[model samples]
Target: MTETVKEYLRIDGTEDDKLLGFLIDSAKEYLTGAGVKGTDSKRYELAVIMLVTHWYENREAVGKVLGKVQLGLQSIILQLKAEGLKSE
Candidate 1:
């Protein structure tokens, strides 16, 4: 049976929260590189879901490293978004 999309996406207000966001952005890039469409790639989705669960379970250790990475990524994304808004 096919696994349904996981609900952990709703997690908020922790270091893992930002890491999850970064993982999602990375997963989209990965899927695109593999020629997979977001709507049709169950395989990509499942892979991301599993990786997220692994991170969540190990957050005590992973969170410190991920938090630093996520902060940098979040800053970049915010800058891009600001530029886009200014351009429009």
Candidate 2:
């Protein structure tokens, strides 16, 4: 798990084990509270880890990225609506 986050963040070495473990725990807690229903896929788990790590590394970028992600999700919703597909 730490390896995945390290790879995503392009980090190397053994100096950040504690910090990465803490962030991994934080990511898990955050995802649990954020209603991630399943803990099955590695991709999903890695995404949460990457997001938390990104926020930890760059506080300012989180807002911008979040805004862009929200807008992208909104666009997807609109497209689905246009196609008469229901989105929960």
Candidate 3:
């Protein structure tokens, strides 16, 4: 998962491995709290990547990129929830 995220972010170094790991964990936790499961789905992986990218790039309180990523994240979460409901 870290490798996937690094590829998505085009990052190539171990300097951020620790931070990326935390971001990945945080993303998973965030999704869990929002009632999102189905970790096997690509949507879940995408959500994590998107979240990590957003949080990483915007760590300095920059709002410029927040709206776009937030909307996409919300969409992914909604889709994941809808999919979960279908299976239940």
Candidates 1 and 3 compared: the better one by TM-score is 3
Local lDDT at 71 for model 3: 92
**Rank list by TM-score:** 3, 2, 1
Per-model CA lDDT versus the true structure: 0.48, 0.59, 0.85
Best by lDDT: 3
What TM-score would every model get versus the actual structure? 0.39, 0.59, 0.89
**Model 1 alpha-carbon drift over 4 Å, by segment:** 1-13, 40-44, 51-88
What local lDDT does model 3 show for residue 68?
Answer: 85
Q: Write candidate 3's Cα lDDT for 1-88 as tens digits.
A: 9999999889998999999999888888888988998469998999988888888877884223378888998999999999989988
Model 1 is weakest, by summed lDDT over 10 consecutive residues, at 1-10
Query: Cα-based RMSD of the predictions, in order?
Result: 12.1, 6.1, 2.4
* Backbone clashes counted, model 2: 0
Model 2 C-alpha lDDT per residue in residues 2-82, reported as the tens digit of each score:
887888788889788777877777656655554453345554565566556666676666423365444543453344334
Give one digit per residue, the lDDT tens place, for model 1 in 1-88.
1123235555534555555676566545644453444443344455446545555556665422255444544454455445446656
Error of 2 at 29 (Å): 0.4
Q: Which has the greatest TM-score?
A: 3
Candidate 3's displacement at residue 1, Å, is 0.5
Ranking by lDDT: 3, 2, 1
Q: Report model 1's TM-score to 2 decimal places.
A: 0.39
